[model samples]
Target: MSTAIRPHLSKIVLAPMEGVIDAAMRARLTKLGGYSRCVTEFIRVSDVLLPKRVFMRLCPELAEGGLTASGVPVYVQLLGSNPEALAINAQRAAALGARGVDLNFGCPAKTVNKSMGGSVLLQEPDRVAAIVAGVRDAMPADIPLTVKIRIGYHDDQLLEQIVAGIWSAGASELAIHARTKFDGYKPPAYWATVQDVVHDRARQLYINGEIWTVADSYKAIQQSGCEHLMLGRGALAAPDLANRIANDAVDQPPMAWELLVGEIEEQFLQHDCNSPRHIGNRTKQWLAYLKRHYPEALQLFARLRTLRDVQSIASQFTAHRQQDLSI
Candidate 1:
């Protein structure tokens, strides 16, 4: 199979972050302009074949030809330990309109790892290979099959072997988070280590981790020698990080906190959720990350954290907008 890393393909991608970069966030971020593609949060696959509703719930972009409103493609990601089950779900995702399928072998959450899923598979390179091969075979050739993995579970000792197995299994692209499962979300992404293993592979290797700004993105590119970078928390913290990185700009010019809050409001209103509590929690979750970049966001989160009613949150956002206008 041909590699997905084409010579012309050098762009930033949104990382598949569970509970964060849902369909609403993807549409909002892509609309801001920068991300080349976005991956949905990992759809957990267990024993049975997941239904279309599950995929739809996770990635509503599937209903619109798998592209965000701004035209960025969204890939559906799956996480599980069973090879056949993963493949069956991958096939169903494709049939239901997933433009691409990404296999997740890099989630390091204790709960996920304990369940014999996520980065725990990194300890078993053979199982990773089999899972990737199964998914690759199950999906249509037109839809790209990608894999996301950490360097290793406990260490980078088997990094090379893991990469080799993933490529041999016919993954079109590979994203290395540049941290061991044990490393968690610490500083120092170990970008330099990936250089020794990449060594002229045809597959596209994306470097992800600890990139919080455009400067960090440049440093990651310099250290990893990879032009393609994936943004996770960094994008969440600074919503315009991808735009700045794509434009080769320094960083987003300071904007009013109310504008950012309004964007969040827009996203929340657009989302098709049955409960206002879900929207309220989602808004608070976004504000928690935004606090990293905007002090006002911290204040906003503090005010809204205890509120379960979406209308109350929206009222606060309205007041903030009015306050900004008054100023």
Candidate 2:
């Protein structure tokens, strides 16, 4: 690993969440503070080298030195079972200016698993090793190569084998989501299981999943005994989460609904695509995540859910802001 890549291993990172945490969302979150890096939503590479446009479409930061406007590095994540194709795409992304590459073996989505991608690879440790070795060999030696996986597929039986495979295969870092495929997203993340596996081989292991607040962050660090963390839904639920974690604060001041609306509008405007419905839907998707942190977000989402016009939603934000200021 290059000297540049090693420093990032210790920093807090944002997880690559499909259909969420796009370039705009990354820009929004990183600007709020305290994320050392963010991973782009996984680009599915099954066969053939994906076009440059596909990478840029998923991660516009690729065109901007692979860093958000806030200067946080954004690594491109790839999900697939084909070793050669994944290597081809990883090289392509690096050539196109990706700061790093993350292989996804942890996503438990049914469609992804059924397609022989994501956590499904956990059942075949040799396949996982092959994929990691292929990508690591294909990319420049200086660019960091990382693997993300769940504890296991059906249970924790394969946890140690999987980590051993990743480490032996030349991956510079490993991130484990503290649950098996059977565990899904519900039930608290089993941090103790992650701790048990990482305890023996501590080389750059990052714990991810269910780290929702500053307290959760502390508990995860204490229990998992891993200092590095990757935030997913929790970061989406509260954009300032990484900032709070970095500052070691019990709580950051709540963002006003009006300010949150402004951030959403900014994301909408940053999306240069021609689909207004797409923009509206992305806004609503983010608002849905925010509902977990802000009750006002629920009311806002309810008011905006039926609207297909992005302009109409923007107008609603204006009205809502006015109402909020008056109060």
Candidate 3:
């Protein structure tokens, strides 16, 4: 909690990382401060409009006025190539009280691509525009429609055209992940490439990629020339990242390793994620990211890695928290 503050110039959004950043994580992170908004993991849309339960299961925040507990608006994200199906689904999400709708054209999973969802659609910019326009037309004009995408599917050849299509289709905002589908999560996000693309000033454009720290945030902004950002694994790696970047205060130390471990233990014991069998699963998965920032996570992960039973993990939490008494 260092007082060092530099005052950042743009918005910091919590990126949607599918299974990683769910509602509970959103609540915890948003409550910590500095995120302008959060986007839910993509809700897969296909031939038919999904049931209301599907939307509820993915984004329970919709029940709370589409805002996280800290009042950060949560935008419902839909992934699909079918314009009609996506449109109806987007409409349903809005009806269910979504603050906004985001179209995901950037996921790189082979299974998702094989199904003609995610990055596979980048091969056809016409359909991309059509999908955006369709979803836009179906939802209320006041409900914002945002689009997220990689530079391209296999290469960035269509990057310019695809971005133009998204804006022309009336997307309220566009977040570019700064890589091609083939690039996956590789390093060296070509933030500089985005500097060359034509951007719509009237519409917000967000640059997203390997932004793991405050220094990287500034570099990405300087290179991409985009004022805003969407943080993904980077945010999980350092949970207070959005605040640090916005406050422009890297001098402040990150959340104490012990404090963060305490928070994870509490979140773990809650058991409110995907399923019962997956109780400690999210905590373990998160440690995989946390280890990148906090070495303590690695030691804790080693102890809890093999345990799935609640009692076993809870016991580990007890031992971990006891270290505080010694201090």
Identify the candidate with maximal lDDT: 3
Model 1 TM-score, 2 decimals: 0.91
Q: How accurate locally, in lDDT, is each candidate?
A: 0.83, 0.84, 0.87
- Mark the regions of model 2 whose C-alpha exceeds 4 Å error after superposition: 1-10, 200-203, 324-327
lDDT of 3 by residue, 1-327 (tens): 544334248898999989889999999888778899999999988799899999999999989999999999999999998898999899899999999999999999999999999999999998899999999999999999999999998899998889888888999898999999999999989999887774545228789999998878888887887879899998899998888888886776677786677678778877434376787889999999999998878878888889878888888777765653343
lDDT of 1 at 199: 73
**Winner on TM-score (1 vs 2):** 2
Residue 170 displacement in candidate 1 (angstroms): 1.0
Model 1: per-residue lDDT, tens digit, 1-327?
322222223588899999788888888888877898899999999989988899999999988999999999999999999888999999999999898999999998888888899999999888899889988988899999999998898899988888899889999888889999889988889988888778776238789999987777777776776658899998888888888777766634534565677687776666623484475777778888888888888766777777776667767766665663453
- Candidate 2 global CA lDDT score: 0.84
Against the true structure, what is each candidate's TM-score?
Answer: 0.91, 0.92, 0.94
Candidate that beats the other on lDDT, 2 or 3, i.e. the better one: 3
Candidate 1 lDDT for residue 289: 85
Instruction: Tell me the RMSD of model 3 versus the true structure.
Output: 2.5
Which ten-residue region of model 2 has the weakest summed lDDT?
Answer: 1-10
Q: Which stretches of candidate 3 lie over 4 Å from their true place?
A: 1-8, 198-203, 272-276, 323-327
Instruction: Give the clash count for each candidate.
Output: 0, 0, 0
